[model samples]
Target: MENRRSRRAAAAAVALITALLTLVGALTAPAAAAPPPLPYVHGGQTVPTYSYADAVRESVQVDTHLDSDHDGKPDTVAVDVVRPRTTTRVPVIMEASPYYSCCGRGNESQVKTYDQHGTILSMPLAYDNYFVPRGYAFVAVDLVGTNRSTGCGDVGGPAEIGSVEAVIDWLNGRGTARYRDGRTASPGWTTGRVGMIGKSWDGTLANGVAATGVPGLKTIVPVSGISSWYDYMRLDGVPRATDYPGWLASAVNGRPAGTCDAVQSDLNTAGDDATGDYNDFWAARDYVRDASKVRASVLIAHGLNDQNVFARNFSRWWDALAAHHVPRKLWLHQEGHTDPFDIDRGAWMTMLHRWFDYWLQGIHNGVMSGPKVRVERAPRQWQQQADYPAPGARPVRLGLGAGDGGAGTIDTGRGSGTVTLTDNPNLTETQAVGDPNTARADRAAFLATAFSGTTHLSGTPTVTLRFRSDKPDTELTAKLVDYGTAARDDYLANDLSGIENLATRSCWGESTADDSACYLDTTEIVRTTDYGVLSRGWTDAAHHTGLTRYTPVTPGRWYSITIRLQPQDQLLAAGHHLGLVLSLSDEENTTPSGTGANVTVDLTHSTLSLPVAGATHLGTATTAPRLTGTAPAAPATRSTPTRLLP
Candidate 1:
């Protein structure tokens, strides 16, 4: 009996030794170095401060030969701790990009990869370093593909966001083996809150991910972002006319088009997927624009001059969110598919800090207690209101008669005596004037073609009209202008008179010096006629083109169309009035080309349904002021902006 017991004890000893050996092996074995760290490159140089992509690369680190979940290929991802602000352990910000920024230079074809990654421009750009000192660790993700990471690039859906959520999971010490606690430290504290950010491509991704309502993600800053690729990129309610080729020339074709090509190709070839008439595919992607589902706090910034994406797009989202009682804020400026607030990138960084602070740090930095909106009043100024346009903008409607007589005759009733609409001005070049890439000195002249008069406009402007087309199809182009006088053609008092028009000065950030020092004498302000920087936006009416072209139309016919210009809060200098220029076109609105394509029109029979700021119709506040508190600190900001990141 004694011998048998001794033998049993020896067997137990052998089992214990084997277990110890396995433990030592795990500790001593060198884990593979993560996917070769993404080369810290930026603007043609290997930058160290740009080391924020490290955590991103680490989280999806690749191993051996294959994936375990039956995903076809081995997973390759890594997470680089993009330090936003300094701290022992700080909240994380996921910088979602369609394609990595390491490759954004123009291709020989003049094509840009940005349109596909437009969301990236919406987030905190290369300013991750700014967050490091403020107690946040910003991360730049390579998405599913486009870099060393694995998996195909999915725009904004379950797969891509699930990948991101996986990263969040790892931070909290879940599903990870490289940590002190047998698994990585899935701390309840750190991963309890996370924030999302992106511009354009990244912006859409951030907003999409927020829909998942991950426990850690509490806020998202979606700038110039699109909610639905199908709706925003193409198809407005009818079959698309293979319209925005820019999606291919500028968005895809460049470096490695990736999934963008798949999406765009699908559109280019989809003969039946034309307009979003019934909202089919659009309904699936437009989440935020239909809010009962979105509960996270949001800060939306948009580009007023964004004809491509259109500033008014945010309107759909704002209105929907308001209805659902979702907490939100906004900041719009005169920019094209980009951030105008970036004049002072730090200002962007500042906002990021505050947002993350409120949601992640649980700090009462006033972001949660601040106004519902803060907008940049154009013609050069900024304003803050508890809500957008402040409760008393008062909608004003001024009739746009059929004549260049400087006085738009009002037709209170229908068919007064003029041709209100027709088709003539159709070409794509208006979007190229200040377009840095193709701005011919001469092309600048034709841009302000029909631009004259200072018709006043406040708040958001939506033009409702009544008309009949002389043809089955007709096009309309409208530009909202702040009519101000030319700055001076003779160059008499030019500040750089000696050096010509080369006045070297950094001028982009928001300034509120009372217009006295920066006085824009709008009273005497008139169109520059040749080189005025008038703010404007446009929309095409192909969807509502009531059959005119290749078809038949009597001499005395009529049609109905509504051209809604982008919204604005521009301050018309005291004497300066807001104006709208309407004309006909025969082609797609692919280019921002100037007016005058020609068909014909009957002025007397036209009517316009515009909004004015009078006593009867100022959009009334639906409820008592929900905002009442002292102004908070100047919110956190981002980094340097413009072509002169100087």
Candidate 2:
């Protein structure tokens, strides 16, 4: 009898195994929601980062406390400041942008306070990597609710501000550590100067800390930063409806289990509106509104063709600083957000060194002597400006007619559109065979599509869209395309709509499957910026159909808008073509979405504001220099300054 029962159990086990195997086989394809497991060895600890000569090894990650109101449930914050082998105590420029380090660490998790440390990147190449080896104390702080951080994550609010001040105090108060004695192991800043550097979220925080107007904050580099969240993720002051829900979910879910209770909808556009009266909550956070409060010398970098965040964000910051007569410099490129580190590492390192020396080392390299601005004149060539966005440039309007709108520019308007892609939202192009990786991938369809007859239009393109929606609120997105790539075209970029891929660690982190939208620094580029829907790994096509599009009825109710698809400062030489497509909604990375409009998207007042780089100094920028004969490679070993460690 016992043997019979055992046989029955064994039979059941075999049946279950068979079922699971069948299921897995049926789904052998990629798991859309699954992310790769964390790697055994971190990519860091081997490569040198900006702030360290060797991989840093501290005895234990320290946990700091942010007791803002002194309630027993202390607001938990954690930071590790690696002072290295310095001669004396050092002043610190702390910018905790939560750059992907604290994600998987397991330390101590608590109610109001938590502390963890799993987020190490392709090495400690995050911001801390840049600060640690430069003889300054490099610290990565988890404010309130990230990693094993304690309290509730305030989402870059007052909590971050308080925690930042707290960490500064903690460093100042610590007498010694196992690695170095604070009093004896620091030369500190020779000038007692503290500075901040970061891009994107970190960049925003980098500027935010300065708003407190803290003393000793000598300089700030807000790379790809914006003045306001509304401006960054919304269009016309409307939080992106399609992408906001997923965005809020991604950030909140990153917090410890119980610290945050807000569901995805809680922070959706509706939820945000329910909580606030107007865009007031967003106004207080705008950088321009508080630009006057910042006293640090600033260097602003932006990409002119940045589809993510419009140049308007950086313009606001630059404009505000100019109004206040604040000392600032600007750098513009024609790529996506931050300059791609993997590909543009060498140039970035050079840029970093020049910046740090001018600010930290007090070197007289005449670093800020010129306009201190740089714009990519053309392929592999960049030009300097005393003030960014040089003065010779002005907007020249071009129009398209109701004809075959191939690559040329013509006068356009007085026409109407009735069709809508409330359903179809896939991009128009994909990379051609044998050249899929190039920028030509997005223009899979046409060099020019005829709306009427073939109209010979000239110059760069801009679309002046006069649109209205049925919904009370809406967002309008436009993508400018130039079909056909030369054998060696180097100026195209894959602009990602940040609306979709909000989560999917597979895209943001080191997952097995790769994504295209997340990283968009294609060749023939200059600079980049960040903006709406917010970016992570946007590529989910399903969610795109969730958009709510409206139609226009009344006259003058339309939102008359003009979008600069191509940079005005260029010479359109011959058949190197351009095209513009309108979308009430475009795809996001993981948060893929589409337009739902049945309205008329009249190209009524649309025209290209082309800044023709005619035959002269500006026109010279049109030349795309070919990679010449082989250049000699450096020796196997080379020496870089300690500050340039990463």
* TM-score, model 1 to reference: 0.62
Candidate 2 lDDT by residue in tens digits, 1-646: 9999999999999999999999998789665787432221123121222324342333222334544323456564545444445344444555564543333210110112112433222223333445445444445555455544555544445665656555544454432212213223322332356667666666667667776666667778776666666555544323334435334334634464543554333345432532122244455456677778887888777655454555666766776788887777776664545443422445665566566656754555566776657765333456665553445544445443222221122332233222222323443212111121122212211112222221222223445645554443333444444323322112223222111122222111111121111232323422221101111111111112221222223432555555433232222334333344344443331122233433344434544344433222111111121221112111111221111000
lDDT of each: 0.44, 0.42
Residue 183's lDDT within candidate 1 is 36
Lowest lDDT sum, 10 consecutive residues, model 2, at 530-539
Tell how far residue 65 is off in model 2, in angstroms: 9.8
Q: What are the per-residue Cα lDDT tens digits for candidate 1 across 291-319?
A: 66675777888765554454556666777
Model 2 RMSD in angstroms: 26.1
Least well predicted 10-residue stretch by lDDT in candidate 1:
515-524
Q: What TM-scores do the predictions have?
A: 0.62, 0.60
